[model samples]
Target: MNWIDELTSTLGDSIHCDEACLLAHAGDKWFASHLPDAVLLASTTEQISEAMRIASKYNVPVTARGAGVGYVGGCVPSRGGLVISLAPMTRIIELNPADGIARVEAGCLTADIQDAAAELGWFYPPDPASRKESSIGGNIATNAGGPRCLKYGVTRNYVLGLTVVLADGRIVRCGGRTHKNKQGFDLVGLFCGSEGMLGIITEATLRIIPTPPARAAIQAFFPDFALAAKAVQDILQAGHLPAAMEITDAFTLEAARKHLGADAMPAGMQGHIIVEIDGQERAIKEELPSIMSILQSCGSINAMSATEPEDIERIWQLRREFSASLRATGLTKLNEDIVIPRSALVELVDFCSQLQQTHDIPIACFGHSGDGNIHSNIMIPLDAKGNERRAEAEALVHELFAWVLARGGSITGEHGIGIAKAPWFEGAIGSNAFELHQQIKSALDPLGILNPDKMGL
Candidate 1:
């Protein structure tokens, strides 16, 4: 049978093959879009296994998808292959409240799981910025993180076990519902950020934590980023662990100020750091002063403003709205998720300023500072020169990654290095690690069909 007939015979009309529908499954956040041969809606692990087996037999690349909200083009089907969407598989298989662990389908939304667990007085802490729309599978595949990752850690740390379907359609379970496991190898971790190069994730068992009794938000404004940088170091040095820590500079603040309006934040401030501390009220009262003192000592032009509960919501709304506001700028934003040591943040930010000055580009900078992960978005212009400037943006994007690596940082802090950064894999991980990755891929799929063209075997 032909591709469509063969796929339809197995998956029924649930397969979406229209060119317009296939276009929807093409690409994600950063990579350019392409037409997929077809999109299949999978509802169970059995169905996922069936799809993978057939796709592998046909030698068609299968791009496993969650919500397709990934920033690094991990979910995008760069090759015109099968887009195996897992959205319908979102089911909370088990909520082990007594054990503080839960088993969920890979298609479940990450934030929805958090909300569901929170309602039961539990928490799932590896929150991605796109938690609202991002799926648990995408988070696990990318090992996603957010501001809260400062203390709770990222996705890989929380995933106790996973039910994965190998590239050859064999089901291999790894890890278990336990805190400690010195198994043969840390294959669990190896697959966590594999970006679909290794296997197709069907379900995952996640570790959870007890929700804190109280949570408080702190907002510190800095006249300059340097002072803001110092305040971050001071707060961490003070030995107080915060649930979340984030930084926003002038360009981003301007975007916030304009998109969210003057009331979102003080119009004149050049930088802002929003931190959330949770624990006993007594500890917060004591640490709150120290946090304020650090910001002030770092050089606060005025008494730092207090965020009313309403204002707290307003500020958070502003921060969360940043990605959307950026899209309104009329240019495709090349988001670079780079991580550096806390000490190197100032240098990275400063270098970005130099980069913009030298290349004459506009970039919005912000990130989960407590974790030292920053998103430096280079905005391509909308004028007639947009294409030419776009070339410069693309070139510097890799250059920026190289600079981050030179300073002992990662090309992607939270976002996975999927097809978007696949070209630079050799520069980032070197031949040894890249070879190890290929070896793992070969072991998983000898035919090399799963996400074949995107992540590079």
Candidate 2:
């Protein structure tokens, strides 16, 4: 029998070789897509280990998938072999507040874990925009971050332990429920941002903190992005660390005004900033006014502060609509989540503005301003045939990445270096580091059957 039949015979009904299954598991939110020979809807760790063993035996490439919501092509089954999907393994095995830990299956939705923790008076703070649809395992794989990561830290910080399935089908448990573990090499961290190339994560032990009793938000409008960027620095320099600080460019504001109507925000508002703080009710009340004053001092034309939950959510709703508003412009949006030093926020926006002017491209910048991880989107107009002018956009992406590297900024802060950034991965990490990556990959996946052709490996 062929590999597909063999997978079916061994894995039973969990193995699917139909066109629909193959197509569905082929890609994610990225622009690229390719069909795998077979897809395995994995429901348990054992199933994944057994499938990996079979793939190793057949010398077939294996790609692990989660909820398929990644912006990069991190989970794309580029090589036609087997795609093991962990979406069926959605289970929170334990939520132990006593130990301040939550043990979750690989396919568990991030939002579900957050909601579950909230009910128990705990908080899991990795708030990726796609939390409702993205899987915890995928987040761990990408070492994902968001606006909240400015103060709370990224997914890697919350990961205390992991259950990983090796390329040869060995199930190894790294770290434990303990908040601190220094037994050996940071094996858990080795796989955290490995992008599924090192091993497949079957389960995770995450650290959660107590839920803050009170939270408040402030929305400020600026005449230009430089002042908004300055407000970010001024807020931090003023000895305040917000849970999240998001900034938006004038282009995105105009798009929002056009798409959501003219009343969405103040007219001709060139820059927008949203600051969030959480703590005791008394503390939040005390901090809001001071932060609001700093905003005003930094040239905020208009500012609004909210302490009520509904009011804060309304403010965030506009922040979350940024990408969709850009999409509504009938242009192909190529978003790059780049990171620069906090001190370079103004310089980065200035660089983006110059690029926009030189290339005749509309660039919309927004994201976690406090952390300097800005989403600079390059908008490409469609041709007469309605096809995306992707070639020009991609050329501009090359130029933008070059500029970022020259400025000592990262090409990606949250999204992993999948096919989209593979060409520059080696250079970005340096020659010595690139060699080490290969050594590690060879050590773990000697046969090279797991998630091949990713990260330019």
Candidate 3:
């Protein structure tokens, strides 16, 4: 029988081979696109197991898809096979406050879970910028980290258990609901950031924390980038660990002003740093003043504080618009989330300035400066000199990656090694480590049917 017939017979209407479905499952937020042969909209673990069984029997590649909101093209089905979508499986199974755990299907939206937990006076702290649209499964796949990760940690820190489906259609459970589990091995960690090369995640049990009483934020504007970077160090050195800390460069500030109007950003600000503190009301009240004073001491031109939740969100709203502002400048933003030591923050910004000047490209820098994971964007006008500009941009990215690796930095911070960064995977991990990764991939997916072209595996 044909592959479609096999899938259809096994999964029945759960399988969709239509053009629209194929096109929909083809790509993600990234630029690349490639249509899969069929799309399987499985709503249950059994359906996914059956679909995988058929695909394995025919040796057809099966790429698992989440919300398709990933920035690194991690969910793009590079091979023309079946795209197994978990979006239809979204369900919040349980939210036990006493147990401090939430059991949910892989397709559940991150923001939805956060909201659910909030309703019960609990907090799920991994707040990626794409949380509103990104799926929990997608978050786990990339082991996503957000601005708050500097304090609360990433997605892996909260994942207590996972139900995974293997390449050959076998089902397995790793970890458990308990807070601590020292079972056979750390399989949960292995699959969390495996980038779908090992197996497909069906469901997850995540750990949640009690909600803090109050929160406040300060937006500090600096005369230059160096002082802004210094403020970050000063804040940490003063024994203050804010929930989130962010930094933005002059290019991004100007872009925000142009795109969001003159009042969108503070006047004449060359550098900006946002620090947020959350906890008891009295403690936050005591902390905000000290942080503001540190900012002023570090050559801050202006400092603003937000105490109310609405006011804090308003400040963050402006920060979140940085990406859109860059796009409004009519340039293709090649966002690279490279990370370095905290000491290298100022040097990285200086090097970016030099790189932009050398290549005559408009580069915008911003992101979680507290943890050294900055989103360095190289904006290229694709409409003008498309081919030549594209080539130059590629060369610039290579240079940036090499410079970062040489300085004990990583090419990617939160975004996984999807097809976009696969070219640098082996070099980033080294030959010995790459071979070990390959061995694990072979052991889990012998047919190489799961996300075959990703992570250079």
Please state every model's RMSD to the true fold in angstroms. 2.2, 1.1, 1.2
Which residue pairs overlap in candidate 3's backbone?
Answer: none
Q: Provide the clash count, candidate 2.
A: 0
lDDT-superior candidate, 1 or 2? 2
Over the stretch 1-457, how does candidate 1's per-residue lDDT look in tens digits? 8766777888787789887889888888765777788898888787778777788778888888889888777877877788889888889988888988989999999988998898899989887878989899888888888888898988999998988998877888998888778888887898798887788888899998888776677776788888888888888898988888888888877776677778666777777888788777688777778887777888865434343557567556667877777877666778888899889878988888888888888888898888789999998775574454777887778678889989988888888777777787777888998898788888888888788765566
Write candidate 2's Cα lDDT for 1-457 as tens digits: 7777788998999999889899999999999999999999998899889888888888899888999998889888898899999999999999999999999998999999999999999999999998999999999999999889988999999999999999989999999999999999999999898999989999999999999999999999999888998999999999999999999988999999899997788889889999999999999989999999999999997699999999999999998788889998988888899988888888888888888887777789998999889999999887789887788778888888888888888999999898888988998889999999999999999998888888899
Better candidate number, 1 or 3, judged by lDDT? 3
Cα-lDDT of candidate 2: 0.91
After superposition, the stretches of candidate 1 with alpha carbons farther than 4 Å from their true spots are 2-6, 260-268, 301-311, 321-331, 383-388
- For each of the candidates, give the backbone clash count: 0, 0, 0
Error of 3 at 451 (Å): 0.7
Point out the worst 10-residue segment of candidate 1 by lDDT.
300-309
lDDT of the candidates, in the order given: 0.81, 0.91, 0.91
Instruction: State every prediction's TM-score relative to the real structure.
Output: 0.94, 0.98, 0.98
